[model samples]
Target: MPKLTKRTIDATEPQVVEFFIWDESIPGFGVRVMPSGRKSFVVQYRAGRRPRRMSLGPSTVLTCDQARTRC
Candidate 1:
């Protein structure tokens, strides 16, 4: 997968099913693209033995760099 840069995000068109594009550089830092074409920043991490997902905000509200450093 490509790095989550502004260009990458813009180039990634939403698909029929929602999917996540994780940043290889920052483990869980990534974005979620809904089937509706909505995009949001997301951070995934383990809560105890189980994993969890958190939505930071819409992609319009946070930049890739901001999302990367947030989690």
Candidate 2:
């Protein structure tokens, strides 16, 4: 799987849906977009045998830049 780059995030509904449907190989990132058009970032990765996941918090509360820093 390729490393997730900042350029990959969609920032819009149509692109977000396409990303999930088309990009299934990448293994380090997930997203939660809100009805108000806010997006929350998540980190998904494997640590040894277990799958590790972390929530970077809500987008409105934490900017996209801030979310990346948390990861």
Candidate 3:
């Protein structure tokens, strides 16, 4: 996806299955949208050869800028 922005995030509608939108500017930084319509900021990185995933926080609690900074 494009850069992580309020507009882009807001414009994304959830589907029956959960989906992810990764930030183009920040590698591994992204947002996850659940089928329930809940949104949260997330970061995915490799811990050595193993991949790790962590949730920054809910989008309702953190802005895109804040999440990007945390990433």
Best by TM-score: 3
Give lDDT tens digits, candidate 2, residues 1-71: 23333454443464334232112444465565555455667787789999976767754576545665676
In model 1, which regions exceed 4 Å deviation?
none
Candidate 1 lDDT over residue span 1-71, tens digit each: 76788888878898999999988878888889999889999999999999999998889888987877778
Root-mean-square deviation (CA) per prediction: 0.9, 5.5, 0.7
Lowest summed lDDT window (length 10), candidate 1? 62-71
User: What's the lDDT for all of these models?
Assistant: 0.88, 0.54, 0.93
Residue-level lDDT of model 3, residues 1-71, one tens digit each, is 78989898888899999999999888999999999999999999999999999999999999999998898
Whole-model lDDT, model 1: 0.88
Q: Provide the lowest-lDDT 10-residue window in model 3.
A: 1-10
- Deviation from native of the Cα of residue 19 in model 2, angstroms: 8.1
Candidate 3 structure, TM-score to reference: 0.95
| Cα RMSD of predicted structure 2 | 5.5
- TM, every model: 0.92, 0.50, 0.95
- Show how many residue pairs clash in every candidate, following the order shown: 0, 0, 0
